[model samples]
Target: MLFVEAKWLYNDALTFMNDHDINDYDSKTLTVHVLDKDRQPVTHELRYLSSQMRQSVIQGIKNNMKSLATLRKHDRKTGSLKYKSEYLSINLQQSGVTYKFYDKRHIRIQGFKKGIRIEGTNQFWNIPSLEFANAKLLNLPDGYYIAITTYQTKRSEERKYKPSIGIDMGIKTTITVSDGRKVKVLVEESERLKKCQRLIARRKKGSNNRYKAGKLLRRAYQKLGSKKRDAANKIVHELLEHERLYMQDENISGWHKGLFGRTVQHSVLGLVKAKLMKNERVTVLPKSAPTTKYCPHCGKLKKDITLFDRVYECTCGYREDRDIHAARNMILLSGLSTCGTQEINAFGEDVRHWQNSAVQPR
Candidate 1:
């Protein structure tokens, strides 16, 4: 579905409401839903929400603002971008809906006998996590145009593959496979995003210069997100060529909470995880499996191995790249004995039960 956003209209609405005292609203208990032309609940038309929903979402922003303020306060610094002063608006997307754009100015929300048309589409992607609630516009941001669409699948059934591989996500490297192949994703987009953010900080608040900086920052972030998603899609497509995929249940979320938060956040590991989970053929090994520390040949646990140790050296002289070792272990752990069973014993539990499960993109 295509997302349409109208920030200009939203700002105008909020400005109008704020100028007049509309204090009867509670943000926490707000929601929005779409209604058909007959005033009946619409299934796919984007739901316009009430003002209360706007207030509830603002709490998240307020908390973020407070934390940012505290950090800046401790550092003894000041800048533009007034977080608390800024208000929020809500938007929604309709599913299984259709729309026809007569002109660039407006379009229909599509579902009932008559459709709802609104203005603005310039800054659409800014809206996130759109859904429906009831028949009223619950906390929907004012003046934003909406796009209603239906999601469809291009492929009827998932394509089958014969080859299979296991992957290990890493920090220094993008991904390490059991097969000794390495893929390094570019991080230039992240660095550029940071630079844009810094530039935004230098601009004066509410000024044209500041607005320009903000636009630049938004564009940079959008580009970064797009790049990461494209890279992820390509990787998933390539990996699916194999009949099966084995991967460790690495603590990717934990990495985000750690020192390398930037790298982890920008990485497509999370996307990969989601895709794999969706596929039936991909089997995820448990988190407790010693994919890295255990020697594949001698079966000896290398307890002292550190992140810097790229090469896995065992007492039995089974030396290989650490990533390759991990990837290969996935094939062993994923024992497909009868059909195409390549049995390889692991230091952990036998994952033979997974053979019957089809691997998804996750």
Candidate 2:
């Protein structure tokens, strides 16, 4: 009900923005036009969404306007914000005022009198001196989730790290590590997902059966997303244990338009790369670096190398798996290349990095 009312307010506010200033549309009683169960237009009143939530929705419109204007200033092609059929997230504008934590497993929302029991509080419940900030109540297809913004002092332990390693991203195997580890990446859609998709195509459009089928499809996609995220997290955790990681900035998305488009769709390589790059320990070699063509042992470029070659056989008597050879060479190449430092976080709120390099003549 909260999400439905919020969506109504958002669409109503967007409609109002089309004619008048959004700042002028902060009325307590929001009247909007919505389709009825019989597929006829009907007038509806938004009474569930709180004043703060409504303001957040309006402020969202103002923010969109600002973003569009900024894009136009940069001469980028832009489009006006359109009315949405659904609003997936509602900003809890302030911490204590809009929402409050009653206990570890329960929270109270401003519009609701009774406390809502939430299960995932165990994630950050034990942290001492944690201060809650603004948060978003997300209406995911599978369930409702509140993503809270919290602040805590950084961990003071100057940690130990493992020896540095280099990585190679490739088509045959997803990740090849300098330490002789190859991790394949692929997550296929579940049988239930395929069934749900087929069921939707057969259901009549605009009917209740179709609506139910669409909901199931969304749930399946959400489940698929959870699996991909889990797989990416596990892979990232294992790789980031090293002190200084090196990898070329290969264009994974470009590979999507080529022969392995379907394979790329089933793989979590893109997510793994994004998470790895966020860590300061990860060093991204430039895109132009010839990880495969350059040989570390011979100190020469193997210009005759082709995609069909599985083994890197150098004139200097270095014979190795092609992927492993490329992975090892990443460590060598990064030392010769110049790179700037930047700071970046998991959420990409701040973005930058620094990498260790050793000077060696090629």
Candidate 3:
């Protein structure tokens, strides 16, 4: 009843916003008419949704309008907010006031008569210094979840320092590190997922059986997403252990139109790249840096190298694996020149002389 009423409030608010000017929204006088399953309007009062929840829904609409205005200010195309067919999230504006922890395994939310039992409270139960803030109640395909924002004092810890490394993201191998390490993270579709998809396709549309199949399909996709997230987190954590990371902002999106699109998607390269890019220690080079074309040993850019060239062989007798060579260039270039440097030879190095000089600096 709570979620159903919340959805009705949200759709009603959205309809009101669309019909009237922005300056005409009034919370005191705004009333919503409920609709039955037959698509007929019926008279009803906003009895289920609390005053705070109603305000939150209206505020959400205003926030979307503000976002659209900001996009238009930046000369980008914008569109109006669409009415939501379902409302899966509700904002708990205050932690202890709107919602409160009844005990270690139960919670009480506003407008609800009974305390709801929850399962995931054990992780934060014994923490003394934890402070809870606003949270969102999420109705997912699997079950209901509450994402809480918490704050605590930072604990200082010593970290093991390792040499800086550069990474090259690819479809063949997910990541090629400058230190000759290749990590492949590919989560192939499981048999269960395929079976679920096939079952969903065979169901008739608008039937209860079809709805059940859709749920199973959603669960399968959710499982795949969890695997990708876990892999990405582990990879990013390992990369951040280094002092610095250098990578190029390759066009992973454009790879979707190529022959290896499925391979790239399944390997989760985009997720890894996104996670790494968020870290302060990671330096991203421009797309035109020519990390693959330039020879790190002789500082020469070879223009004829194609994707088929697995080995990067330069005219100056420098040879290495294509991806590793590119990864090494990322470190060398970033060490000499700042990110976004345009010239290919701006910080080119002769590998032999550079190593000798490093070994015996004058």
User: Which one wins on TM-score?
Assistant: 2
Give each model's clash number: 34, 6, 0
User: For residues 1-362, could you state the per-residue lDDT of candidate 2 as single tens digits?
Assistant: 77888777777777677789877886575787766556677788887888898888778888898999999999999988876777899999789999999888899998998999998788787788899999999999998999999999888987687778888888753799887889987898899999999999999999999999999999999999999999999999988887788887888888888777776886899999999888877888776666787655545567899888999987867678999888876776665331122111121111111123322212
Q: What lDDT does candidate 2 reach at residue 302?
A: 77
| Count of backbone collisions within predicted model 3 | 0
Output the better candidate (1/2) by TM-score: 2
Estimate the Cα RMSD of every predicted model relative to the unseen true structure.
Answer: 12.4, 7.7, 6.3
Residue clash pairs of candidate 3: none
Ranking by lDDT: 2, 3, 1
Off by over 4 Å in 2: 30-41, 73-76, 336-362
Best-to-worst TM-score order = 2, 3, 1
Assess every candidate by TM-score.
Answer: 0.56, 0.85, 0.79
For residue 219, model 3's alpha carbon misses the true position, in angstroms, by: 2.9
What C-alpha lDDT do the candidate models reach, one value each? 0.56, 0.79, 0.76
Check candidate 2 and list the clashing pairs: 342-352, 342-353, 343-351, 343-352, 344-351, 344-352
